[model samples]
Target: MMKTRVCACQTKDVYLPERARVVASEPMTATERFLAFELESGRPLGHQPGQFVEVSVPGVGEAPISISSSPTRGAAFEMVVRKVGNVSRAMHELKPGDPVGIRGPFGTSFPVGGAMKGQDVLFVCGGIGLVPVRSAIQYVLDHRKDYGHATILFGTRTPAERLFVAEAAEWARAPRATYMETVDRGDGQWTGSVGVITTLLPKVTIQPAKTVAVICGPPIMYKFVILELRRMGLSDDRMYVSLERHMKCGVGKCGHCQINGLYVCQDGPVFRFADVAQIREAI
Candidate 1:
């Protein structure tokens, strides 16, 4: 009989030092925008869903934006931006030919390979939250055979505030994905559901144990939506979210993006509910 020795070693972190050029920039809606960039080496970003990239402009600064495109989409990657602050505002002014620095498709990704394999996924998004969740949603849709069912629930302040309207419409039309959207207030022209994002939760049917819930949104939206998910019997470990704060240096050295001991730039922009539930400032 042979005795097995268990050894533990820290995983060597890999950082992407590559530069990517913006191939196109288009308006997804009045407030939301999309930028497509191709790596200089022409290789795909090779990131899992729910991971984010640190986008930098030399004199301006850098911001953490989620990967909005799926890996199945080829060598290029896309980010959906909602022009909320200075860095995002500067990003909106960039053109197709502009150059930007990219470091990481980093942090923990949604547990797609774990709970999501052959299980249903419920994507709950609000405002710009759709940006990160879109990456995972698209991945599941692209690899439909590996998953069971997918439900996407999105909400915004108004019709004009809706991000990725065209893509949302297209996803709604896809047979494999169920898409539903709502707005807080609507103009007379709007026909979709009108209420806070939490309202959409009760309308959907999901098996808590067999479902993985991914949520991302503004700070306020997270609190309310998370409460609803908990009421639905979704375990804290099965719920995932992405956090956003001002990020100066993508590396952990800069304290500008810290949430207590966790650096938003390094430890996360994505964290499991089980991990962040104890951090007071995390929400």
Candidate 2:
């Protein structure tokens, strides 16, 4: 167990975790919770959209979690965690003012501030996949004028499993933005579209030339979603994907996330679809 957390961190030391304080922790669903943390060093996390951080607890261990808030949000960073393992279970036990360990803010990020600016931005997310894509959504919305028409498409397995309900609704209502949500299975409370996320794609229109698509979800979702995007005329070069499933150790030393010449933790967790299209395991 950690006696006292480290207040500062060195990027050169890949094994160390910088101490951060929990500013807020709240439940988003039965199994998932929202956590916001502020670095004890009083500096911003400096993460771009679609990046992730490796988190730890005193007696438990470490897990890589996607950064759910945009870098434009503020000094603090946020994550929506599902209680599934020792570290995540311990993270659920944290409260306001408690200390936590954070490593990384690793991996590549969405091109919202770079190649994506001035072009139409399209975001496609599924279930908990929204946890990472939300950062780019927040960044795009925060600077809505920097891009063209913004379109967001989200789908979950069920109604109760929906994360960021209120915020997603707000995104739907934003000026110059279009938001649509669906669930594979819906309950009485779920009044939106009912089907896989691809069903909603046909109902919308986009500019194939100017639009940039950013996707995140399970590997299977990536396959089908890209199929529909391809049918819709979006090219692989204009698309980006988040493969957070392959994350491990938050560094290249661990080959758990390696695919041939690519290391998901180091080279990317977010990659241009064209760059990794030929790698069978990249999705």
Candidate 3:
């Protein structure tokens, strides 16, 4: 079969983007849209959790976007894109069948079946941070028997800002799965907890030493969340974080994502807390 490659620039160029067409597109919020794409090569994006890909639009440019859906779920990969800049704004204008260029399933990934196997998995996601952590959450749930209990804690500023309405409900229903969510401020219809994500942490009991926690959220949120986790007995080495950095080039050479000696694009967008704790700029 003939494949429709988006860029004929050849694979020798490390930045070459292959062709992909959007298979599904829906608005998750006023400013964010959920999109799914199938590579023209007829293969899956084959990405692991906590990784991102650089999307390219000819007239615009490239922007790094986290893979929001679990690789275990489907052939097409998904992303949660916010209309914050040029590339993303252009991405929002795309429809179900529009063609786009995809570069990689780049960067380090969460250790799901590896280090997390047979261990309790706890996920803490805040606001848009949930966008990337959702991938790991889905992986853990998909292979539920391979791990112990699954606890998910999510928080957003307001009810309107909550993402993944349907999926959140499913997580709550899964066996051996614990899902709790909160909004900093609630509305008339909001009946759940009302506070920052840290407030939800105390409600769940975890065997901290045997549990591996994956956290992704705002910069300010990390400090408080980690402090609370330490108070709960989880050590720095057992906790992981996904960072949002300025990774202009998915390759390490760009230096845009450098924090001390590490390049987030190559070293990680995802890292174990203890490994990066000393790098003042990394979080």
TM-score of each: 0.89, 0.94, 0.95
User: Number of the top candidate by lDDT?
Assistant: 3
Off by over 4 Å in 1: 1-17
Tens-digit per-residue lDDT, 123-198, candidate 1 = 9998888888888988888888988779999998998888877788888887667999999999999998999999
- What's the ranking of the predictions by TM-score, best on top? 3, 2, 1
- Model 2, position 178: C-alpha lDDT score: 92
Any runs in candidate 3 off by more than 4 Å, and if so which? Answer: 1-11
**Displacement of the residue 47 alpha carbon in candidate 3, Å:** 0.9
Candidate 3 residue 42 Cα shift, in angstroms, is 0.8
Better of 1 and 3 by lDDT: 3
Candidate RMSDs in order: 5.5, 5.3, 5.5
C-alpha local distance difference test of each model = 0.84, 0.89, 0.92
Write down the worst ten-residue block by lDDT for model 3.
6-15
